[model samples]
Target: MPHGDPPVLGLVAGQGQFPALVAAGAKAQGWGVAAVGFAENTTSGLAAETDWFQWLKLGQLGKLVAFFRTHGVRQVVFAGAINKPRALDIRPDFRAARLLWNLRSKSDNTLLTAVAGELRREGMEVVSALRFVPELQTPAGQLTKRGLSRREQQDLEYGWPIAKAIGRMDIGQCVVVREQMVVAVEGLEGTNAMLKRAGDLGGRGGMAIKIFKPGQEEAIDQPSVGLSTVETMLEAGLTSLVVEAHTSLFFDRDASVALANRHGLCLYGRSDGQDGGD
Candidate 1:
């Protein structure tokens, strides 16, 4: 309606700090934010942080598009995590049911890709959340003051490809490695549960490796580690963590690094074509 209004960015908010982070970044850039927060999955704090906010159930795809269109948002970013198990309880609207019925598999990637495609068809572009917050991207090399020991380095080398392979199969992005043996692979229960299992089986000094899934859309479901991750690792007696640099997201970097350093845990970011740190 206004001749010189700032562009509005729509945010499909899920769980965690990611939606809030994206909204803050967009606002800092002098852009308006319209956030559609998921019921139960999204934090209530996001409503006050955004220019406009609406709460929608998980599979209300039709309402999601209508909210963006009504807010004059032509571009949107999908941010944060939707608890996968809880999503099963969703009462999808007709639009979402159609999309679900046509899917060959109910994998995360397939569902998200279909949603992105639907948004595109509805005159909206689904952009990367990182477009607003590039700092969340993992930096290459050792992040903690403590470098990886030889045994840990070996475990990383052993686990990196294994994690990637598992990701490729859409199984999970995280795996626990100890003494060159695979301890636990993340599944529906997620990284925290897997780490707890690894601690029980392998005890302390295991390495947690997380990587992006091959052939998956980076904008939607990139692997991420944050303060909670470090806390879980500490509780699980895991001593080291490795993530794909540039591809994975590292949220709350300062706090996470400080916690890892305090526990003498090694936090390393392995870039493509780079050797594991010693």
Candidate 2:
């Protein structure tokens, strides 16, 4: 209620570095971050990083709304992902249940978009979490000393649209292909699980292709990868990764690249139909 107070932005944080990245970016830009973290789904250390922090269960829509209203937050950004397997256990309150009742689809895009709409109705604008952290966007070109080989390039190009199409259907964000045959598709279990299956089905030297879905909620929910992705790919015996550049998130890039290099794997950033890597 005081004049000269910095604008407070509400952060609906989920898991991983996404929330922290947004919080740091917000503070760096001179904005106050009032964050709510999901129990067991968020890092407890995030409490120390926020101006105001609350731990809430996944379906506490009423509490979430009241908290932001109490803090006079007019803008909100959703970052990170709810552990979908764990999300099966959420007990939606009456408010969140009411919102969930009318949904025809419970896909990630559908649910998040609906939640954003609810926030908008409550006078809180849900903006892209990357608004302040534009640098988190993936870089273009070969990210490791090992660039794409001819076969790897074939797989990347072959799988890009398949991955994007899966995303477009709001199914998931990853597809595994080798020698132009799709071996795995990401489903409810998520990427790492899918990679494990690809290893069995595609054998060694497959490529994993990930991309931002066409018509996805831009910069809100995105395709992303990091060191864990490379580690999973290594475990899966996949030799190359091609993720959409400047559109998707690439967390822990240096660590991922170093790991990929150690294994002589290719880490290529791409945009659909736009090949900028060697």
Model 2: per-residue Cα lDDT over 98-184, one tens digit each: 999989988788888888888899998888766888877898888899888887777777788788788899998989999989999
Q: Give a tens-digit lDDT track for model 1, residues 1-278.
A: 37789889989998899999999999999889999988788999999999999999888999989988888887889898888899878788999999999999888888899999998998888888888999999999999999999898888878888988998888888999999999999988878888889999999889999998988887788899999899999999999999899988899999999998888999999985567963
lDDT of predicted model 2: 0.87
Quote each prediction's TM-score: 0.96, 0.95
Error of 2 at 179 (Å): 0.8
State each model's CA lDDT, in order. Answer: 0.90, 0.87
Candidate 1: what lDDT? 0.90
Clash count, predicted structure 2: 0
Model 1 CA deviation exceeding 4 Å by range: none
